[model samples]
Target: MKNIYSLFGLLFISQLTFSQATLEGSIVDENNQSVLATVYLPQIEKGAVSDVNGKYLVTQIPNGNYTVIISALGYETLSFKLSFLKNETIAKHIVLKERAVEMEEVIISTPFHKLQSENVMKVERITTEQLTKNGAVNLSQGISNMAGVSTVSTGNGIGKPVIRGLSSNRVLTYTQGVRLENQQFGDEHGLGISGNGIESVEVIKGPASLLYGSDAIGGVLYLNPEGFATDNETEVDGTGSYFSNTKGFNSSIGAKTSGEKVKFLVRGSRASFSDYETGDEYRVTNTRYNEYDIKTGIRFQDKRLKSTLRYNYNRSNIGIPEEIGAQNTSKELLLPFQEIDNHILSLDNTLFLNNSSLDIKTGYLFNDRREFEESADEAALRLKLNTFTYDVKYNLPELGHFTTIVGVQGMLQDNKNFGEEILIPNAKKVDFGVFATTHLHLKDWDFQGGLRLDTRKIKTEDARNPQDEDFIPSIDKDYNSFNVALGAKYNFSETFTGRLNLASGFRAPNLAELTSNGVHEGTNRYEIGNPDLNNEQSFQTDLAFEYRSEHFEAFANGFYNTINNYIFISPTGDVIEDNRVFNYVQNGAKLFGGEIGFHLHPHPLDWLHWESSYETVIGELKEGGNLPLIPANTLNNTIRLELNDGGFLKSPYSFITLENIFAQNNASEFETTTKGYNLLSLGFGATVKWNKIEFNWGVNATNITNESFINHLSRLKADEILNPGRSINFNLGFTL
Candidate 1:
């Protein structure tokens, strides 16, 4: 970590000797008339919007092969790929066809960046713009708007994502083309990465072990970072937001610059909040938190090689909430809180061959977590975790219409306890995997299949104080698995498509499950590990169908999954250290659910849109009981009004969302059922230009009724805590 900044400075200096090319183009309608449009190079994050006359100019673009996309509100998007040479100026003209619904968008998570309509497996994509419109304050909250995605949150500071009723180590999160390791095994740990600097997110809702190796039995959350700025250009942006309920504030500023062959960017942000108010106007004490984050990246590109280096550092102080207290708003936190720092550095490099490519990714992570109780000056528990990971993939030349890719991945991890309390013993873990996948493209069908083999080894060291009865004994274990996946996409008609997929996934027991022996402060329980635990394996089948046209779009998706040796915590009918004792156990489990949704736009009232969706999931242990942590069924409805070209308001929009949550009576042993509730949210946003600067602003109100309710997936539900009350938030951003 000490030398990373020096390397970035050296790379920035080396790119001063090169020159780049430029491109200019005009986008028009089918009649060859001028039409305003947005032109972008998705890979480079460069481009400009067309003026009223449909003219656009992009400079400082590296001389290489590229793809540019042009999109307009009432026209079909256009994508073009071309090659250029240094010191060259290219002129092009493009025309777009009018359409009501958008064309299929390209997905970057797959080996081949294919459009969603052409991919064998289905993937859900969300844009940063959409997340902002949804009034989400954090990464976890933003993703919860999607179907089959929920969160187990502790107040407003910490949240863990749950996908189709599975969380923790069962899900995988990837950023900067590498896996994230931030000691996520703990229930109180939140996603370390911030929502800043991310352009989009993609979710794969089923087993993806074949593509990502292990820890993907539930799903994968893939975040795409911001691309480099355009050549010879510099951009700066700032944002500020205020929350009324918590008296919270968030502020951030970012800047980026690009040269001929090099680009760099940096961003810093700070957020702080007081206790949140409940529906009854009672303040939840010690739920306040503050965070500081910094992120930077450098990119270098040549004719055949492109590389990027990114680093992020985050520090947070979160106060654990136990009960309500005085209603005064204060940012100062009390005792019984947590202090955490996470550091991530990653290097991604790609080498292009004649018809194939070689891609390599390397990453290092460092996490330090400390818990303080009774007094802020002393910590009760401290843990440090470090991980190193590497992945290498080679794309074989295309044979006829088939594309194949082979890859190998490995990771080394070490965990240590540095404080008095030890929930898990010091351990070392190693993982290695090799996989191969192929994609077949036909006139009307897409076929994909892959197979992978993985091996993991874990070794634990005895506790620091041998005489303590809570100390766990030393142990060593090895686990192995073979996984396979097959999927197909068939275009039944011009506006109809069908997809089916089957996959197998597996997860090795984590340190907390295999070696825990003491009380865990996060969960407020005495946990006992099971050294004899085996690997958890799953098989899932998914089916989906979609119909799209100019006036409307609809989709239905269903899945059923079965797992063997599913690990879960069960009460042992005993108490230790004033806490209930919970033992790690295994049982067979099955889960089934489906999601359906539709979007409609009346012919004449094109500016008005209506959308609705419903999602449900049921998980049950094979031994005649319900599974814990399953999310309750939910339905959502939205009405939106869009003004594409408001003279002064520019892209003005307003929306109202009504969410209904159904009661959850199917709960596991020791879990209580939760009542249903309804919530209404409203928001309005617009962009305006003044004094040569662009300003974007929005106002949002959530839970307008201030109804008192508990979410089944919330960790605080066990304590019968009500969710946050009505909140009015105001946000503003500026760019120049």
Candidate 2:
């Protein structure tokens, strides 16, 4: 009898261990005809494709609540939430609507993964595929295409994002679910990231300190990495591109494979560019660059746990152009150049419980920056930065129509100098933050609010060089602040919606702003820091309205920001070492801006699209002077034609765009005004599938008129250097 009882117990345990949930679905169009589509679960990073009969199946799913998305080409995507029980099989059917615009995707930057249409806070999302289709030269230039967004450009290879009218340390960037830090306080420093292997980018146009820590007083840019392949699938792809003006080329190859429980992917990319030519056919000397990048990821999923590990390595050699001289088509770096290398590694894990879940993420990064001015082998300035970060969040069980999340985030960073010049002293920084956010849903309204408290401490070692002007005193300081955010979305009718948000953000003074006593080589200015600087705090109010219909969509967004202790640098009418002396100061400031846009696809002319947008911003100090580096007003218009059904060539498309930049008359004490300019661009592309392989090709021409002009925010504007003009690009790719 004892042996029989033991056998029964063993059988019961084996059954419990093997039990799992399954999800099966069917997809159809509005006409009730079967359609091929992709079904994805964002929570577990699992996906499936519908067959000819519109049937799809996903197995080994854990027993929990999940959001499922169904999407197809030239059709409106569908998203809904569902729950599953252990050892249960659920069946669901969905019907999609035909549309000309792109489908909405799941947002990862937010704590809760929700579709853009269902989110309370307004966010702008753009895919890597779209960026490529739009013919962007780099990641920084790509994001500038969006409304109310621009870039502060140094050359063809270096650019930094500017939201509204704020740049530098005011805006924060996040990649692989962690804050990206690479000494962003300097205007000449670029975003140390590559576009290869990245899936999409999401932009929060206002204060985001409640979600991210300090340095988010302006906004946040979140980059999401590409996902793994579906179960039991393997794929390989390669891409190549060529540019005319710069005589440049970019090449990359990647492969990914997935099993039932494990998945892996890797990619390698390289790019090189020569001196770029201006409208007058004169090459800008030393405006060349080269880059090498590698990305890889691995993932594992089981009944109750899902985990992913990702890594990226990037190296860049960029030149600094002073004047139009020594014209040559060479990709080699000249004097006064920058060499930077970055490494990033991250791990993310999610654990599902009976009615709740926990998410944990950790990241490590290392940055090496070197500048060579006098000698090719010797670096005049070198800075090394290392950072480690962690974030943990707990999702409480949902109650009726309410959902809540509580989280903790922190980071430890160290900066060191190895070269002869010391821009900022060796420093150790620590940060800690805690916050809670909740969402409430009703019949026609969605409400979201959160509160957070953050503390940062910085300690630096003194660097005294009596022989030179480099002397920074040792200092230890701690800063603390509390922030809050509240937003609401209301549906006025079936075709109209309104949203309003109020948020507060803060930023602690960086090492460069708190303790600097030397010449900044890039800006050619002597800077003096104030060790007694206080934290910068800001409050902003945003209002937005959106209208949607079958063939037309429109949106309007406006914001007003008030800042306290806004830090800026101004000349002290003194000169040191042939460089103007500047001192950091703080005062109250205000910024106001708005964006309006509309898209139209007439009923019968479904293949044609017309879009227009206008953006403007104004910044002024409360003491009565225009803030420095504010972007000028701009307008953009585009007309596109889509030929989805073409013999041999599939999904062919073409577009023409016109951009107008208005004059900037408001200038600071040491700034100059800029004149207005217009630019025209054209592009066309198509996809071809032969047997089991697919080929994609495109051609894009920018500044087709060869118009010579200068952007107000260009670092080279001081020298009256023109921007690159009249560049034709050709791209080709294949998938197997």
Candidate 3:
């Protein structure tokens, strides 16, 4: 600390203006134009990270010449040098090439089921390779296949993803670091995010309010946009893929063009599905659904600045049947349609300085969603919400060993409810937050931490001729919360890393939880609002161990989280004094779980691959009661045979998974016990070339036996219906 202070003091006093030139530039992917984080500086250091905007500021060089080298994972490296002048700042841009077998480094290699990944607790990751190779009608199906993650399927069409047994607003969703805006309270609001354009899915289990903002208590699912080279060096290049399954059919197309000054990328996909059948040959009715999405982006690359404009539109029709006891025979389907149109435009600029640089990034986001019911009975439960977000941040790395990422985010949101609404209020909410994160790397260990303070202010106005004499025409609710985290990882060896983490996190009550007043038919709830609810706070701890080998990588972790003032709706009737309806409130709570993952290769040849994973989670309240809908013990085992020039199979690739999701029985209140079952699946894929075009063909079978068993948390399992039986899917994709 003294040394740092002395260095700063000297720099301030010894202002001997050394006329040195600075090199400032950015490295971006050819497709999405997103910045590459991990960069190899070669001369100064082997590994350095580009700022969040894909920009890097290198300084402290004399007029003498030097070489600059930049390399990113999954892409080729480039080296260049320029003659410099005193007090001059030069901006440069580099575009990298993509490679398969001989990658610069793997950008994403971790599986979503890993338990002890890095130092982050409950963290999960899905790579682009899995997204492209696996044949799923939608992204939700693939995510639910991971250990410890389940789905609350209101039939196949409206399945909300649950991690460790929490969904809706409890777990926040993001698209490329942007928060997903949808009705987080309802079970049928799953189609708001379009999965077609996502290249990766990262699940951060447990409360992530430290990184994300409010409503991340259950965790966060981040759908990252593609930032890889889908096009070659040619003028214009593209890829197309088609897929089919017993329940649905899907197709995708993408194209990109690159030039000296600009680049453009566009992608789109459409999918439609019918009701799915269970192992007993019973069809889950009202499961039919269809959705389409389109995304386009333009990038301007220059010596001094790089900017991108992105627009995405997603629309889907979801059919849901009202749950009716053991006989789910509701012919009146509630067609809750969602047309979420989102747009974001951003610009990042860097000003080069000697020994330091200043970076500024600003972005704007607009999200809109409108809801309608196909049936009149469900019309009373409709809503429309529109939100706009503006974010900005500045980065200055002049201070060594400490880089601060501070940003201000604000949201302007308005919500409306239709129907014979009891207490429906036309309301608006403004959310503002300031957050900062710092990374400190040690010789043998690294430490990272962050803090954020967020506030939400909501204003409501209600007016109707039928209003009761005592009814109030206005409402105001303000919520504020503080978030914090601290963690560190120790590098034991070249391939082994172990980490331990402890953090305190909290999330403020959302606008809906605090201001909602109308009845909702989705959950069959005579809902009410609570204006006096407090923020939910939690304490978390994590321990992890990981290993990486030439052909094998694995991780295992155990984590614990205990919450105070846990929020939920009690079964009590409305309190009399205020004549307010019943609402969800806060109480004390506890949660704990663990996960284990591994990959082993003992074969004489390198073509054989074997992997296995397991995860379990449980929750309880302060007064001693189990939390609802938590995932049970889950297991997954997979093996693959690859035939290269000389390997295990006649084809390029073949794989199989003996997956088992066991429900030992729920011990919590209002819970039902379920029998355990094992499900086995098989898959295969091969590389084929048509003339100069190369393509991939993939096919997979799920539940080869048509297993008739429900997972521990499946809602239908509460009644005798367990799970959907056997299904098969196939996909064909081509790339240049």
Candidate 4:
């Protein structure tokens, strides 16, 4: 009996061992000395940090294939594919190379998560930390720092992103892996998203319809959320910032904890700003704003599945400045202001199979927007929007050097009016898209291509009453389109690379474009929409070249885009109720632009860096005239110094930047020319450690010379309102 029991026990032990796998690795520098690093397998959401001896181990992994990423500070990140079998233990050794610049991270916006150097398409990425270091007061202002990206500003408190030369419904924004739908059709509407709890931002400068479908006809702005803490770790953090120009202050607190199988995190933030002062020391009345935001997330992971749920709530009270009148410093909103409340909830799940995986994501969003004009307690216009979206993708098993993914995405949306006035009729919208994409890799070449089909339907209810001046007839319409993208990346040498891509995109007419027959108070225009409107289709060609080495990096990117049936609203030489009349029309349009820049960190002076870049874009109708709201050319130069350590301060750094904006002479008929201007900025920061406590502090001054200027895309351009200037900003943060 004892011998039989022993045999059974041995069999059980063998089976248990065969069900799990182990991965072990050692990391070292070029000199073969131990170097601490992080080894992560994103697919399974598992990772480990190397010990002082440079040894790391991850166990209990199921049998499958994965891409492992190894990264460390001051070292070039490395990634490769690996396969593991049941009961198998894999041991690997890695040698990291020193780099003058920071290491590159995996790009999540792309279908295949790969390093920038390995992607077929060029994508611009900047971390929120970097944006903070640049002294950006808000997310919209921060993104404008990137090449080929600009913003249409109503004021410092409200701004919309304009990619290349397109805004409104053309550019798509995604947060937490889901589309952000907050009534984006209006020019005065802001992003409605807070900067708190966001990790990084990624921009795809050209059409990405093959991957993201409609609304991406112009480009995509992807916002990545902060990740949870490492396994069995808990952390708490707090941050506060102050801005002098607006007499503004913002503060946030967050906490995160992660165990072997579950993780949770939450963050709360608030901000208040008074009227902003211009370069002439004139306070712009009712430019003040206040915001409250909350973000939370939870995750569960096991051997075969990983799931995450996230939620975000935001409320904002933004004042509208018609002209400079009241100068008193007050954070409370005044008349002619907007109050917006937004809620977003999302769930993501991934199921890992033997050699493949499936990913599903779903999201729900609600937006309540109210405008107050006559009385503080009464809203002149109120609109409510609800949206539900879903996306499912299946990664097919890799075949040789080719990887493929097939996906389906769709959304259901409804809009309603709750106040006395209505900009758009009560409407319902449906969107569905199917796509397939694949990537082929070779020694020196990578080829990527995809095809997609999309369909959108819009239905509206009649809003024609005898007492109402604004009338809209009920209508139902369906729009369909097919798109494709093809791209190739070639390595010219170890340090040089080139890429070429051709893609097509399409966008269905929005509700405002098809049914509006009322006054748009925001633009002071009476608008008439066309019931018969065709979809806008675009084709673009992009070319880019990059060269990188230990001490220098340079890149040049150029693109040409042409659109058919492009929609635009133009003045009709008529007036109604003291407002100019405008009509929506379609025409062919073209835009061409490019960005070139370089970074130099000369040889032994690795801590000293010089960076310069220039960007320009030209837009015009195929027949005649220039397109509206095109940004002017810009040149940016920066000198930076990084120190290894300074007494009580660790990794102290400072930078000076000079930006020049060229005059916008190529303006539309109704647009006025904007004069060129220059701005100077300086910033410095350092980390301090005391006992077991560590904190970071920084100070930045923008428009140091107090230069007065107006951007071409500013709505206040016609009123000769200047942008804010000469602001000193201070920030402090710490982690526990």
Candidate 5:
């Protein structure tokens, strides 16, 4: 495309005739003024997410010297290392101080961290204050060791987060990067990802499709809330958790405060469990689980600007062990008057002047749901849904090193099933979109590109039967797609960096994949719908490499996929009396995958930590066939020993882990060949601060030596066993 506007018109005309040197900024919390949406630069290692008000703008070229890092989460991280002047653009604004429970160096000068490694991508982060234990469940058990990610369950109220071999909706969750569009259609919506109110969980593996959008094709997890905070200023703080693992027991609590301008937050948690045990005999009789949660939020900043507001409430009852009938039945998986409610509101702002800074954002979301199971005539159902969402964004500055991102998105819907007159007719649905992006800075090299446009509309309620009663014209449908992305990076020395990306993607056809007919029974199948369907194009590529130094680090990536239409679920009409009707098609597909990671700590001995990961995935069917549930070829590892940083032990630090997972046996196209297993896990932690009060205690061991495997996406089958058998998880908490 004019070579991406002639490489941003020659990197903004060589930053307007070489005179570069101006390091300015603004990222706030303690009443400084602006935090916009979110940001943290790290001398150009790249980090920006603020845009509801707290503004920013970074440029390039031999400007002498620099340092500026501002973080957000509960507030408390701002670095400064001044010196810049050459051809000019300098502005400054900073204020973030709320954490300090006794800094030991505060996790290394805080640049917003969670195990970093980038050149090709290796996010790996985990924070809920190190997983506020207390019966913690969901969000894949708080992303434990990361690396290629893994977590699958139909028990413990079900957990999902498998990457590499992919997971429903081709992975792509991001609660803070937006794009959780109910995960592109069912898997029981995986309990809507509720990790007892999360705060940190980023495992971005591969193909991020340019800042996330679409099904990510196969990567991007995000989910950041509560950035991170400790104490120092005017404040209130909290921590609570209690746990038991063998398949049960949990607790919850929360609180927060920071005043200079304004800041407040609250959290709540509750968990329950019963039924689980199976090493090949006895005790796998319909697992058990439960839940309850509530949350609140508020924020106001200074320096440039900042604002926030949040709310949440949840209720649960789970246990869906294959709805026994031949005599193994006793499940609920989600029922007790089954309920799930979500309401969200957001606003952000940031602006400076004299070089660049302007970012704003707004949001609103509401969802109401009630779900239960079994219906292929066995009868015993319940399904209801209502969703509404709106969003807006913009970022511009550094017209030279280029950083221009623009946005607009929307959604509206209403649904009902089993009410008879509402089976895929004018139930109402809408979607709209717009996008733009740019970012470049040369010398060592870095570049980016983007473009997007989307629109979709679906309705039903049969009026003339052009498929159903048209709330409009037999209820109509229309779709549009246009997307593009390009990337580059080069350094090759200093530690190594060389990456490349080429993308052209699009995904539109959600709303339950075009008018559903119900009887999903949560994967038991029988979900009929088509409505002509189309709009799923894709063409991706990636080749990467990264290497770092401190203790040790490494990353590698390789990918390729070519799809067109690619959406599946076919089998039209046959066996009406025995049961069979499936529909939801769009052929022409292909997929590929790759990933590898490693890290080794250098110091902290007697406080050891090491990590490992390996992954692979391959999907086909452009006439070759063999793509059903796909996910085989995986390996994960973790080893840690921290004993005591609370000195001599007793409460402050203690850790142990030896975990591994390998699942291979597809038997071709899922005729069931899952028989690969090895499991062992152990854990320990302690912390009980004095004066100001704080406490955290944890204990865990899942399948320690009780190995009874199966994970090709097990729904239920004990030909060799899978799930429920040998367990122990515990936690305790308090903070304020």
Candidate 6:
């Protein structure tokens, strides 16, 4: 402890005399009156708050071209770019316009960071605070509230994200600017991400291959990690939560500190849960799970170079819930469970040139997965995957109201099996892609377009000999494709906006689709692969409209997508070792969907808010058959009441919500129809100050009615299992 303090002391002393530039700015209302606001620089990870005089100052900033964002309550946000020189003190003033609600947030998933209202493509964002409100148990469930998004759930512990009728390898997930590559080809495999270190989630509902690469044929879910504190600031926070239904517990602690030229942060968290109960008061045995994770990062910046390094280690133990068993509530897992350990390391660097800048990112990932079933002495299956990836992007100098960016990305991966059963053969894969995009900003309209090309190669080792009963031959294949996207946003009127986008995406066949030849224990089926399968290509067109006013806000979004050579699994007439046999096949498919929502806050009672949203999707093959694992239509309604600051309560809020899911009678072969159900939920939250320290707390109750129902996407739906119900959750957090 003494040595640690000394090291910190030395680091703090080193930053006391740093040489850098400072940016100062003031904000004023339309009447030229002073307005207190927040001034933030995203790239520099520094910010300042304006005082009563409407003046804010951020010091120790590296010299470079930077975008500054100024935001205040009840006013429109302002964003602009300027250049700063070494040891220079620049001053600027900004005037704000009054708005009924807060301005839209800035989106970072795109090649060019811009406010959602200004971007040509529509993106959905959910913050950590919003996740907490939903009382979710995992990262996938945390995002299930968004429109056009759901989950293929096993129980309280396992869930895979489904976006616009797509799941598994079809959808892509990114964390800290690097693609997440776990063994996601299986139906029971969930996203191995902890919500503790994540600050927010951004979802692109349609194909984003022009920015991302192959596998993005469906969409992208981007997780933004928590950032460091501002300059010369230090903070520590602790949080705890409890759940009634599962007897679950979650705890975490984090600390961050930033100096003039150095910044660092660390966080540790743990969570555990027992078997979850159904609405009928019956427990789903062997559904228990536990997880532990640690994360740390450090960043340094000079006049022209900024660099950051981050690392995360995660370990999880999940039980495979099946038929009912004894009713005892034990957190320990029985046989037929999974153990996973994942490690991620990343480094990012940015160099500031005269006008244009270069950004470089590198990452390393290791995934160790083991499944134990029938006995506790040995693992039935074990797979180890290693991946190394890099990305480089160059931003050209702004010219004639246009911003351009060009980039290249690639990955190398190796997969090996060391267990009794091999679901997929040992393989080595390589991927490379290049893209260029440009954005044009006009007075009332914005236009953006991009093109990308990608190539992938796969080689598998021959694991079978002529003497073996089921010999699989060695395989080598190469896949390549080109994609493009074009989008436009127009301000139809002062209170209305419209956006249109057309995009194309492509996906190469995964290892499981090309090599699997045995039973998949997770899905309880024998699967066969096709070596001649072709790549899948998709084209989608999206249109959106938004209307905003002082009393109400409304939005409508629609999409139509078509895919060529869409791969799906069909049951074969033959049976293998008492298990049904399924083969991978391809066909043409189409999907259409739309979402509409409205928010109303009457003038006389602004504290009362009413919101309603509805989403639907239809997917079918060109040969006249329905697609499997399609989500049912859903509608959601919420009523909220907001309270002003009072004696000990600050910004107290309460809400009640109703969710209605429609029956899914349109099912594919080997699928059963699912009955719909309605759910009611309630929650409340408030912040209180004690001894000069503020504490935030909340309580949520889900499935208040205790109704039992099954979800169409539940893997256990075939077994007639019910979803979780009657869970009361409580959470508390405080800063030190």
User: Pick by lDDT: which candidate is best?
Assistant: 4
Instruction: Report the lDDT tens digits of candidate 6 across residue range 1-736.
Output: 2453354345333323234688887889999999989898776567798999899998767655677888887687888887776688999988998764645666878877777877899999988777887787778987988999999888877888888898888899998778999888887888888899898899998899999898888899999999888778898988888999999998889999998779999999999999989988999888899999999999997666679999989898999987899687799998889999989899988766645567788899999999998777788889999999888777777788788988788999999989987878899999989899999989899999999999999999876565775556779999999999999999998779999999999999999899888887757788888989999999999999999887789999999999999999888888988988999999999999989999997877777889899999899998889988889999999998877688999878899999999999999887899998999999999999888677999999999999999989988888888888899999999876
- State the lDDT of candidate 3 residue by residue for 331-444, as single tens digits: 233455433445544444433333333333444555444444554334434456676665544333325555455656666778776544433467788888877777564567
* Ten-residue stretch with the least lDDT total in model 3: 106-115
What is each predicted model's overall lDDT from 0 to 1? Answer: 0.85, 0.88, 0.62, 0.90, 0.55, 0.86
Runs of candidate 4 with Cα error greater than 4 angstroms are 1-20, 60-62, 466-469
lDDT per residue as tens, model 2, 1-736: 2453354345333323334689997999989999999998887777799999999998887766788989887788788778877789999988889977767888888777888887888888999777777777779988988898899988888898899898888999999888898888887888878888889999888899999989999999899988887788899988888889999988889999999889999999999999888887888898899999999999988887789999999999999887778988989888989999999999998776655667778999999999998998999889999999888777777788888888888899999999988989999999989899999988899999999999999999988765656679888999999999999999999779999999999999999899999888667899999999999999999999999887999999999999999998888999998999999989999999999999999988888999999999999998889998888999999999987658989889999999999999997776789999998999999999999889999999988999898888888888888888998999899988
Q: On residues 1-736, what C-alpha lDDT tens digit does candidate 1 reach at each position? A: 2243354335333333244678898989989999888777644456787888999998766544556777787887776666656678899898888877644566888766766766788899988767866777777888988998988888988887889999999999998788888778877888877787788889889899998877899999999887667768898998888888899988889999998678999999898989888898888888899999898999887655679999989999998887666567988988889999999899988655444556778999999989888678878888899999888777665687778888788889999988887868888999989899999878889899999999999999988667877868899999999999999999999889999999999999988899888877757788899999999999999999999787788999999999999999999989987899999999999999989999998787878889999999999999889998999999999999886876889889899999999999998886799999999999999999997789999999989999888888777887787888999989899988
Question: Which of candidates 2 and 4 is the stronger one according to lDDT?
Answer: 4
Per-residue lDDT over 205-282 for candidate 5, one digit per residue giving the tens place of the 0 to 100 score = 544544545566566677766532321233344343333333455555666765544677777777666556566645
Error of 6 at 481 (Å): 0.4
lDDT value, candidate 2, whole model = 0.88
Superposition-based RMSD of candidate 2 using all C-alpha atoms, in angstroms: 5.1
Clashing pairs in 2: none
Instruction: Give the TM-score comparing model 4 with the true structure, all chains together.
Output: 0.96
TM-score for candidate 6, residues paired by index: 0.95
* lDDT head-to-head 1 vs 2, winner: 2
Q: How does model 3 score by TM-score?
A: 0.79
Tell me the TM-score of model 2.
Answer: 0.96
